[model samples]
Target: MSLPRIAVDAMGGDEGVRVMVEGAALARRRHDRFKFLLVGDEMLIKAALENHPNLRAASEILHAPETISGEEKPSQALRRAKHTSMGMAVNAVKAGHAGAAVSGGNTGALMAISKLALRTMPGIDRPALAALLPTLGDNDVIMLDLGANTECDARNLVQFAIMGAAYSRIVTDLDSPRVRLLNIGTEENKGTESLRDAANQLKLAAQGLELTFDGFTEADKICRGDVDVVVSDGFSGNIALKAVEGTARFVGDLLKRAFTSSLRSKLGFLVSRPATELLRGHLDPNNHNGAVFLGLNGIVVKSHGSASALGVANAVHVTARLLEENLIERISGDLAKLGGHGLGNGRAAKGAAAKDAAE
Candidate 1:
């Protein structure tokens, strides 16, 4: 049997080894292919493992000896801790001992480590972070550039759309899921110079989609599921993602307070328990799992820094599915098609020339 390994950055998160171990244990329960290579302090990992009464034998530990904290600069962290927990995790993915990596650590450090280790896919110049966003409506949207690249060009936006579409297909099972540019307005002239150019490019790349194209949309339309793939620059995308997250937390807390306000309200809460739980599950960041750093040579997932054990476990679960789908190669094929024919009716020929110029 082929062994499917995931390197866990044990020293990377706020929860310490305990939650990391618990997350790994949870993953082991979900998939037999999961072989966790825990990278951190040996003594700490052992203690966490001891807490698990029935720890899986598949788990292995690798000592980091050093760690990168949340506040450190990515460059500084990389220079200081080439052998840190995050660095070791990246090395494991690059060395092919693990099919994927999941880390709840410094976002910038994780991205820097991944780029240095895994590099970018051949046709992809930059690797963008994509977060799965749940909608109040039926289908959820996959939003990209959650903060990988601070500045992106029209070409980059086009790439994000293609990557998002490919991901939506293999994982979300939406063949040609609708693509929409995240804009301040829905008109063709909306957004920055890059976005305006990107919109026109999308028109030329019409057949590139697995589904038909939907136009530009505002942030509010996100919760409405107006489109399947939402493409935006990293700065704006990060702001939107955090805004939604903050709002979700605020509303959730308010609801909790309301539920226990008085005897009458408490009775009302029981009646709404099932629906309320459903809403909570949908809004929970843990259930949303980690964000994917797509367009890489291999899988490198960036779990939330504040993620709990359940969040880590969910990250592992989705990552396993990504491996089963052979996402790297899958993306290559689809993207190669875009490089040649699909988008905007063979705009790839023009796109290729532009890509060459950009280089």
Candidate 2:
């Protein structure tokens, strides 16, 4: 099925135009239906496209002289949104020139631009950063609020669960995904009032929403594969994400050291090379490269700044899948099911209160 073209921030990543163009080319090769609006310096994009005639034929270049640097702050980036490649790419989505936008630039900048351009979807108070983490089971687990809102209230958590589950359904193809809140412990009375309240609300609303409300899961169990969605405040979720990444690195480094420790160990490594290769492939970040900003009116996927062509392709694939699955509509449907369940007015009222306080 041919879908709408995806807008790529061609000058966003570490390698800039070459890698981004190559990645989009790679995606086009995998899915012939994929088309692109490559936003960057026209000369650089044209030069890069020389290597991939297929992409050149299928893509259109939008000249964007400015690029958002990795170190640029969101506020500063927002000021130049219309002029920068990152912002233009997002603007393409908002303007209906593209189905979704993908960027490997500054996450904060991309988030800010996307939120400003697309705005939050109806019934969503805040947009959360959600990503798929590799797990021990057949499917990867979805985790949200990675570093979006540092402190989320119970209402935000509930909204995150709704969004995460909608995403999980698209990615995992599960009818009713198992959803859980990340907490200090699994006990009913263990967490903060917000956690307890969100859990209570989820339990009450799960049946109507088509989600399996599994009370709580601790950090260590996030990738165990028992649950499909893990929700948390950005502070805790970001820390847990880093911890998981650190542990993966630690294991890889330890294995490398052990294998090279002695000649005998090197011989053993050769014998176990196939098994280790499989493990390495499974743990590679490239295999899971996209992080979606859920709750936005339009889709915006964040690719790792250092991601390779393969990683960028994966991010594009993710954007395509979400578009095909109608993720925003699904979330809206679920939210509609919660009518009279106390969530209908909570987000709006909360926003109003916050606005009044600011005034």
Candidate 3:
């Protein structure tokens, strides 16, 4: 089936127009139905597109006079949201010219521009950043609130779980995904008041929401693959994400050093080359490149700044899948189910009242 065209910030990533255009071209090759609204310098994009005739035929360029810098603060980038490549790409989504927007630029700037333009969807308190992480099981785990809101309340956590589960269903094709909150321990009473409260709320609302609430999962178990969704506040989620990434790097580096230690080790490396290659492919961030902003009125995917052409294609592919699956409408349907049980409204109000009193 033909999908809506994606708006790509062609000047956002480190390599700028060349890599972005190539990535979009690669994605188009993989899925011929995909079309693009390339936002950046017209001449640069056109030049880059020369090598990829298929993409050039399927894409349209929206010239952007400025670009947001990686070093710029979110507040600073927000001020220039009119003419910047990242901003205009997001604007295309809001204007109904594109179904989604993809960027490899500043995370804070992308988030700021997306929120201001698309705003949060109905029944959502705050939008969360959700991404798929490699896991030992057959399917990757979906983790949310990765550096979006530094702190989150019980209501926020519950909403994130709902959104994450909706996303999981799309990617994993699971009717009911197992959901859990990230906590210090798996025990119900082990975390903060917010964690505990969110856990309780999820348990009550899970039946109607088409999710199986599995209480809490520790940071160490995030990629175990048993749970489908892991919810957390952005501060803790970001830290945990970094720790996992660091561990992957450490393991990869250690293997490299071991393989080069001696002639015998070199022979052993040759013997284990297939397994090592599999490991490398599994851990490569490009394999799981897209981080989506959930609960927004429109789709906006964030690609890693250092992503290669393959990574950009993966991000674009993810955006296409979400659009095809009607992610926003799925989340809205789940939220309506949660509201049907009265859990979202009642618990959120109580949580707010408790916070106000505590303050």
lDDT of 2 by residue, 1-359 (tens): 56888999999999888888888888888778878899999999999999999999999999998999999999999999999999999999999999899999999999989999999999888999999899999899999999999887777888999999999999999999999999999999998777887887788778888789999999999999999999999989999998999999998999999999999999999999999999998999989999999999999999999999999999988998998889989999998887656554655435533543454
In candidate 3, list every pair of residues with a backbone clash.
none
For residue 288, model 1's alpha carbon misses the true position, in angstroms, by 0.4
lDDT per residue as tens, model 1, 1-359: 67568888988778877887888788778887667888999999988898665554777888889989999998898786567988888888899888888888899999998888899998776899998889865776889989998888777887788888877776578767888888999988777777877777776665754545677889988778668889998999999999999998898889889889999999999999999988888888888887889988889887777778998888877787788788888778767766566452355535643754575
- Candidate 2 wrongly placed segments (more than 4 Å): 340-359
lDDT tens digits by residue: candidate 3, 220-306: 898988999999999999999999999999988998998999999999999989998998999999999999999999999999999
Q: Output the better candidate (1/3) by TM-score.
A: 3
- Number of the top TM-score candidate: 3
Q: Is candidate 1 or 2 superior in TM-score?
A: 2
Model 3 ranges with Cα > 4 A deviation: 347-349, 352-357
Judging by lDDT, tell me the better candidate of 1 and 3.
3
lDDT for every model? 0.81, 0.90, 0.92
TM-score, per-candidate, Cα-based: 0.91, 0.95, 0.97
| lDDT (Cα, 0-100) at 156 in candidate 2 | 85
Ten residues in a row with the worst lDDT in model 2?
Answer: 348-357
Candidate with maximal lDDT? 3
Q: How are the candidates ranked when ordered by lDDT, highest leading? A: 3, 2, 1
lDDT of 1 at 97: 82
